[model samples]
Target: MLNASNPSADTGITPARRTTMLAVLMMIYTVNFVDRTILATLGQAIKLDLLITDAQLGLLQGLAFAAFYTTLGIPLARLSERVNRVSLIAICLAVWSGMTALCGAAQNFVQLFLCRIGVGIGEAGCSPPAHSLISDMYAPRKRATALAIYSFGIPLGTMVGAVSGGWLVEHFNWRVALVVVGLPGIALALVFRLLAREPVRGAMDAAATTVATEAPPSIRETIAHLFGNRAFLHITIGATLVGFVGYGTGTFAYAYFIRMFHMGYAELGLVYGLVGGLSAGLGTLLGGWMSDWAGKRRRSWYALLPAIGLLIAAPTYIVAFTRGEWITAMWWMLLPGLFHYAYIGPTLGVMHNLALPRMRATATALFFVVVNLVGLGIGPYATGALIDYAANRRFSASGLGDFATQCPGGVAAPGAADSLQSACTGAMAQGTQDGIVIMLLVFLWAALHYLIAARHMGWLKREAVASPAPARQPG
Candidate 1:
C-alpha cells in the first residue's frame, strides 16, 4: 500500500506521467462536451430546418439528452468502483462519439431526439469514473484545483462546439457540422485508451484506513449517508439550481442573438464561443485556485465563494441580456461567468472530500442525478415554454391573429404583410429576452443555498476529522 502522507513514494506516477494523464482526461472531457453541446450550438439551424417550436428544441437540448444520461450514471459509476476506469472511459467516449455522428443522419425531430438519447447514454459513463480517478491521484487539499482543471473541459468544449459548429453550419448544412465534430472523437477514444492509465483507488486519501481495500458502501448506504449530511444536501440543491439557470440560458443564448440582432451564424458562434470560453474558463480556474487557497484556512470558503460568485453573476447577466446591441451584450457577458462558474471546483471538491475514497464515484453520480434531472431535464423546457407563452401573449396584444398560426418557427409566413412580419420578429425577440432574464433570477436562490451550506460545513468537517476509519455497514 502507498503511504498516505507521501503518496508519490510508492505510486509510479512521475510528474510527467501525472500531467499527461490529466491532460488526456481533460481532452476526453472536452470531446464529451463537444458532442453534448453541438446540438445547442446548432440549435437555431435545427429549429428552422425541423420547423420545431422553442419547446421542442428544449426537449431536444434538455430532456432527450438528459433522460438516459442521468438514468445510467449511477450503475456505470458503481461499475467503475470494481473495474478498470480507463477502459470504461474509452468505451464511453467511442459510444457517444458514434451516436453524435449518427445525429447528422437523422431526418426529422423524432429521429434526432432518439439519436440525442443515445449520446446521453454513452456520456453517462464519463465524469463519475473520471472524478473517482482524479480523487485517487490528488489529495484532498489539491483536489479542487485538479478537478477545476478537469472541469476546464466544460468551457473548452463549449468553445470548440460553438466556434466549430457555427463555422461549419455557415459553410455547410447543420448535418455536416454535426458529422464533422462527431467523427473526430473516435480517434480521440483510441488515443485515450492507449495513453491513460488508472490510478490505484484511494491512493491519495489521507488515511489508509479509509482507502479502497475496504468494500464500498452499498448504494442505499451511500445515498443515505450523502443526504444525511446538511452540507452536502444544501450544496446539491444550490448546484442543481445553478445548473437549471445555466442550461436554460445556454439553450437559447444563440437563438436570442439571432432573433434580436440578426447576427449571422458564424459571427454569433465565434463571438459567443470566445466570450464563454475566456470568461467561464477563467472563472473555473479562479474558483478552484481561490477555494483551495482560502479553504486551507477555512473550510467554509468552499461554500462561501460560490455563493458570492452567484450573487454577482445574477445581476451582471441581467444587464447583459437587456442590452440593445449584441456587441454591447457580449461585452457584459464576459463578467458574469468569471463569478458564475466559481462554484464548480469547490462543489465537486467538497463532495469528494466529504466521502470515503470508495464512495467518491457514487457520490459524484448521485450528485449528477439530482443536478441533471432538475437542471438539465427541466430548465430548458421551462424556459422554452415561458418563451412560447410570452411571445404568444405579446403577439396577441398586437392585435395579430394567434401567433402560432401567423408565425411558424417565429417567422411570419413568406409574403405576409410587413406589419405581421414586424410583429412576429419583435415578439420573438422580446419573448426570448424575457425568458433568459427570468432564468437568471434563479441564480439568487441558488446563492442562498450555498450560504446555508456554509453554516453546516464546519460541523461536517469536524465529523470527518473525528472519524478517520471506516465503519462496517451491512450490505
Candidate 2:
C-alpha cells in the first residue's frame, strides 16, 4: 500500500526527466496499441480475403492476441518486480514488433492467428512494467495524471492505425500496412533500450527511504493483496465491462461506417482516425485529469467522474450506432468517445494505490488479466457473432430468404455486389447497427459498477489507513 503521505515525491524527480520519460513511454505504448489494434482497421479486407465469419474475425481480434497476453501477463509481471523493467519492456517491444510484421506474411488464418498470439506473448510485458515505472516516477497525487498521459498512446495508436492502415489498404494492401507499421517499433525498441533508465522502485513514496533492500512479495502474495480489496474488485469489474463494450464496438466501427454510410476506406480512415481518435484522446486526458482533481477533494470522485462519463456515453453511443449518415453520426460519437475512455487512467491509478509499491507491476498485471480475459477475449467475438446472427435474421425477414444462399446479407447478388447496392442498403446496415447498439447498452452495466465502487470508497480509504497489510491477505 502507498504511504498516503508521499514524502519521497519531492525527491529523485526533475521536471525535464519526468516529461521526457513519460513521452517516451507513451510512444512505446502507442506503438503497442497500433500493433494490437491495426487488425480492426483492416477488418473489411481481412474478412473478404480470408472468407471467414465475423466470429472468426473476432477471434483473431480478441482471443488470439489476448489469450497469450492475459496468460503470460502474470508471470512476466512477476518477473518485472525483480528484473530491469526497462530491458524487459524493450525486449517485449522488439518481439511484438517483429511478430506484427510477420502478420503481413501469414498465408492462412491459422498462421495469422498464431502470429497474433506471438505478438500477444511479447506485448504481455508492457503495461505492468510500464505502470510500475510510472508509479515510481510520479507521486500519488500526480499518478493518475501521469498514467493518463502515458495512456494517450491508446488514442494515438488508434489514430495512426486507422489513417495509415486505411491508406495502406487502399493504395497498397493490408499486408504492406502491417509490415510498415511494425518495422518502426523494432528501431524504437532499440532506442528505448539505449536511452531510458529505470527509476528506483517506489521512489515516489515515503517508504522508499527504508525499504531499499526489501524483497517484493511473491506472486501469490501480490495477487492476494490486490484482489483482497473489495473496492478494487468493484472497480476492476467496471473497467472490465468498459473494455468489453469498447473493444466489441470499436472492432467493427470501421466496417460499420463502410457498410452503413457507404464511406470509402480513405474517408473512413481519415474521418474515424481524426474524429474518433482525437475525441477519445481528449476524453482519456480529461478523465485522468478529472479524477486527479476530484480525488484530491473527495477520493470517491475518482470513480464518480468515470461513472458519470459512462452514463453520458451510453446514450451518445446509442445514437451513434442508430444513425445512418456519417456526418450526423460522427457528431454523436465525439462525446461517447470522450466519456467512454474516461475510466482508464483513474481505474488504473486506483489499482496502483491499492497495492504495495513493489507489487505495482503484479497488481497491474492481475488487473489486465481480468479486464483483457473477459473484455478482449469475448467482446469482439460476441459482437461479431451477433452481427452474423442479426444479418442473417434481417436478410431472412426481408423476404430475401431465397437469396441468402448467394449473399449472407441478402443485399447482393453473388457476382453483382454493386448491382443491388441501393435496394437493400438499409438491410445491410441493420445487423451491424443492432450489434453495436446492443453492446452500447453495456456501458450502463459498467457504469453501475463504477457507482458501486464509489459508494465504498470512504470505507476502503479508512481501511487502507487502518491496516494496509491486512488487505494483502485474501479475505
Candidate 3:
C-alpha cells in the first residue's frame, strides 16, 4: 500500500504508466462520445426515413438520451466510490456500445428513443469515476490540464462520428453506421478492463487530508456540500447554459447544412468533422492550459478565462450563422469553438478542487446532472421546437395549409409541385438558421455567470488550502 503521508508517493505508478492510463481513459471517453454523437451525424437521414418532426428528432437526440443518462449518473458515481471504477467503466462501455448498435435496428421513433435511453444509462457511468481517478493521479496544479486532455475525447469523438457515420450512412445506411461505430467499443471495453489499474484515492492530496481513510459522503451530504459553495453553484449554472447552446446548436448543425446548402452526407460530414474537431480540440486544450498558466498568478483566471472566451464566441457565432454561403459560414464557425470550449476544463477543475477527495465523484455526478439535464435534455428539443414553430409560421404565410402535412421532414411530399417544394425548402432553411442564431445568443448569458463566479475566487483558494482538514463523517 502506498503511504498516505507522502504526497509524492502516487502508488508507484510510473510516468509512462500514468500517460498510458490517461490515454486509455481518453480513448474510452472518445468511444463514449462517438456512440452518443453518431445519431447527430445521421439525423437528416433518420428524419427523412422516420418522417418525424423536428421536435421528435430533438427528443431522440436530447431528452430521450439525457433523461436516463443524467438520472443514473449519481448512483453510478456513488457506486464508483465503493467498487472498482475500471470494472464499472468496462461494464458501462459494453452496455452503451451494445445499445448503440441496437439503435441501428430501430424502424420508428419510439424504438430509437428507447435505444438512446439505453445508451444514456450506460454512458452515465463514465466521467465521474474517470475524473476521480485522474484527480488522484495528478496533483492539484496539473488537474485542469489533465482533465482537459481527457475532455479532448469530446471533439475527437465528434470528428470520428461525423466522418465515419457520414461515410457509413452514404455507403450503406444509418443502421450500418450505428452498428459499425458501436461494436468496436465492446472490444475496447475489454482492453480497458484489462489494462487500467486503480489508483489510491487522495494519494496526491496534502498529508493532513484523510480522504484515503474516510468513507465516501452520502448523496445528500455531497449535494449539500457542493451547493453550499457559491463558486460551484455559479460554475454549474454557467456550464449548463453553455451546454444548452452547444448541444442545441450542435444537434441540428448538420441538418441545417443539408437543408440549406444541399450538401451530400459524405461531403458535409468530412467538412463538419474537420472543422468541429480541430476548433473544439484546440479550444478544450487552450482552456485548460491558459487557465492553469494564468491561474498561477491569480486564481480568478479560471472563471475569467471562460467568460472572456464565451463573450468572444457569441458574436463570431452570430456571424457564422448569418452567412448566406456555407463556405463563409464554415470559416466563421472555426473561430467560435476556439473560444466557446474554454469553459469545460476550468469549470471541471474548479469543481473538483472545491470538494473533498472522497466527494469528487459525487460532485462530478451532481454537476453533470444539472448540466446534462438542462443543456443536453432541453437544449436540442427547445431549439427544434423553435425551428418547427418558425417554419410553420413561414409556411402558413405562404398559404400552405399546415407545415407538417405539406412538408414532412422539412421537404414537400412526393409528386408535390415545384412551387410547394421550393417553399418548403426556403422555410426550413430560414427557420433552422434563425433558431441557431437565437440559441447562440445564450452564450452571452453563460459568460455572465462565469464572470460572476470569478468574484468568488477567494473562496476557491481558501477551499484548496483548507482541503487538508478532515471531512465530516456521515451520521
Q: Model 1: per-residue lDDT, tens digit, 2-120?
A: 12333553344666777888998999899998998787889889988888899998999899999999999999999998888889999999999999999999999999999999999
Candidate 3 per-residue C-alpha lDDT over 1-475 given as tens digits, one digit per residue, 9 for 90 to 100: 1122244756546778889999999999999989987878999999999999888989999999999999999999999998888899999999999999999999899999999999999999999999998988887777889999999999999999999998899999999999999999999999988888888888777652466678898888888777766666787899999999999998999899988899989998999999999999999999998887777667778888899999999999899888889999999989999999989889887777666678788889999999999999999999999999989988899997899999999999899999999999999988998898899999999988888777766524533331112222458
Each prediction's TM-score against the native? 0.95, 0.93, 0.95
**Candidate 2 lDDT, 110-203, residue by residue in tens:** 9999999999999999999999989888877778888999999999999999999999999998899999999999999998888788787777
Better of 2 and 3 by TM-score: 3
Model 1 is weakest, by summed lDDT over 10 consecutive residues, at: 463-472
Which of the two candidates, 2 or 3, achieves a greater lDDT against the reference?
3
Question: Count of backbone clashes for each model?
Answer: 0, 1, 0
The global Cα lDDT (0 to 1) of model 1 is 0.88
| Pairs in clash, predicted candidate 1 | none
Query: Residue 447 CA error for candidate 2 (Å)?
Result: 0.5
Report lDDT per candidate. 0.88, 0.83, 0.87
